[model samples]
Target: MALNIVIMAAGKGTRMKSTAPKVLHKLAGRSLLAHVLGTAEQLQAQRTVVIVGHGAELVEASAPGPGRQFVRQEPQLGTGHAVQHLNGDVPLIRAATARALIEACGGERLALLTIALPDPTGYGRILRQGQRVLGIVEHKDATPEQHALREVYTGMMAAPTAWLKRAVARLKNDNAQREYYLTDIVAMAAADGVPVVASQATDETEVLGVNSPAQLAELERRVQRAQADTLMEAGVRLADPARFDVRGELICGSDVEIDVGCVFEGRVSVGSNVRIGAYCVIANASIADGAVIHPFTHIDGEKLGVQIGAGALIGPFARLRPGAQLGDEVHIGNFVEVKNSTLAKGAKANHLAYLGDATVGERVNYGAGSITANYDGANKHRTVIGNDVHVGSNCVLVAPITLGDGATIGGGSTLAKDAPAAACEDEEALSTTSAARHRSSHARALSCGLRSR
Candidate 1:
């Protein structure tokens, strides 16, 4: 039999008290309807149709892609009428519960996905004889005795497409609300000598619908729990699972530890033995093995991604923007911001520094309050620090410049031109305070207070 999937999304969701359609509300960073569509995609049905009503234009515009077909239900009547708008071919339900109904459907019998709830108030009671399902009686129409039944219909059903159309055609709006009831088909099927079946959902959370803000929040937590469980099962240690939020994909290796209040977005990957501290927001970055990202660090790899090498240590409050790359054993301390820069092995920028559009070489010690002045009004430039360079506190290396190997820049100095290898450049010209000193790679000390050549 050709399978067709119909999603009934025509209701205005007055209980939600919002202008946006309830199905378009977010659950786990995706619209609720999108979540339903994702499950439907797994079925690979012959045809998929979404019935839209309130906020139809917005819902259709925000919908994920091109293949889905849509029909509108103007001045929505009821659930039965919503399904009828599709002309009755395929299964019917809120998008949230489609997967269970589709999976439970054997396609030969009329199937309803039912749940056993402690409080079955306002729900349609599932009537059964022996092991066979008889019908579903809505609480408003059910007798006092039938109202006590715990198993209730979940507004989801599957049946032969032809039979479904015929049964719906015979439906009447004779109920108290004068609304067409889809549940009426269960009794119609049983009366016609057709077998009616009920399938119980394994996890009740999967069928939860978001009709209000409170309900949406609860659903978000449920989704977060699932994401956390998957990570935990893979050996990732989370300090507090409740405090973690993953808006996008997060790939983790073994022995990875994440602290409280972390939000990961846009496809981040953490390698083995990595530790991410509290309140960090990391997005689209790759953190290598043995890397430790301290508390409050922000790494956003927008367009151009950021990479942290093995054994690299970053932050207690640092920002790494696009194109920041750190080689093995590099250290970026508190309050440092790195953007479009690459720090080679053993490089250290210990505090209050900004290294943008720069290349830092091995064993370079960049002091506190130092910065690479890489942008000059209209154009951007680069600063290069060669091997074994020692940049003093509060100095600024103006871009389009370089500090050769074994160079020493004095405290509070700003350099526009390149500093020669093994040279000492001091800012204090008047106060001969032995301004700056440098020892050559051969261990020979240069004369103190020397002027620039």
Candidate 2:
């Protein structure tokens, strides 16, 4: 039998006090409807239909994937009326608890996902008889005696497609609320000699329905705690589980240690033995093995990601923007920012520097307070530092310039022209350092030797 999953997301969420549809409100960086859709995708149903009413256009815009179909419930009747808009022989349920119900039903019988709540107010009570679910009574319709029942319906169920259609058609708006109740179908199923079952969820949090701002906040903390537990179970050490937040997927390899107050977003992957210090925000980046990301490092690889190579050390307070790539053993020190740049092996950009649209060669020393003047107002250009180039303090290398291999750039120099291989360029005091002089002589000798060859 093919399974059709119906996600009821038409509520206006008046308690949330927002113009957005209730389902469109975010929890853990994804809309509640998105989370339900993700679980629905896992079921691989024959068709996934979304019932939209309040802010229907906005809700439709969010989940407009290839396999999704939408039906509008204009004037927003009730749950029974919602399902009445569907065709025959499909399992219909609310989106909030879709996963537990789908897993429990197995498409074999009519199953209601129920929980034993301490106070089951404002919910329908599940009626049962010796392992068989008889029906459910709404709190408004239930007598004071029935209201004492602990097991309550979670607004989630699965039934035989044809039987459900017949049952819903027979529904009447005779209840206290004067609304056609979907729970009425439970009694109908039992009367027709159909087996009604209940799937009990162990965690009430998983079946929680968000109806207000307070509920949304409660759900967020629950989700974060679950994510923290999952990572710890997989051998990733978290300093304080309650302090970690993962708004998107976080993949951690063996022996990864993340400190408190770290927030990961948008598909970050941490390699084996990587240590992330406190209060770091990393998004859409890859941290290679043995790399250490010190405290307060912010890496946001929005679309084009940042990559940290093996054994690299970055930040007590550094920012790595999109397209920043560092090779093995590279060091990016405090208050430095790198954007759209590549630093090769053993390169060090230490303290209050910026590298933008630049390519740095192996063993290049980028000094403190130095910057690559890659933007010239109208356009952006590139700066290339060849192997073994030493860039001194407070220097600015204008874009479309190159510092040749074995060359030395003196402190406070703002060089707009290219510096030749093995030469020394300084705005002032170019003849001071013996090491710079020796490099200039050796570069000249090497050039002559190469010409003779």
**Which candidate leads in TM-score?**
2
Best by lDDT: 2
Q: 1-453, model 2: which lDDT tens digit per residue? A: 577878888778889899878888887778888877777777777888988899888889988897899989887767888772221111122344555565566655688878999988877898878888999998888899999999998787888788888888899998777887888888888899888888786777766778788878878898899899999999999999999999889999999999999999998999999999999999999999999999999999999999999999999999999999999999999999999999999999888899999999999888898899899899999999999888878887888888899788876667788989887776632223322333465554443232100
lDDT of 1 by residue, 5-115 (tens): 777777788888999887877766667777667666766778778888888898788774656888898877777775622212111224445555655556768888888
Off by over 4 Å in 1: 84-104, 138-147, 168-180, 191-193, 372-385, 396-409, 413-453
User: What are the clash counts of all predictions, listed in order?
Assistant: 0, 3
Alpha-carbon error at 192 in model 1, in Å?
A: 4.2
List the pairs of residues colliding in candidate 1.
Answer: none
- What value of lDDT does candidate 1 attain over all alpha carbons? 0.80
Whole-model lDDT for model 2 versus the true structure?
Answer: 0.82
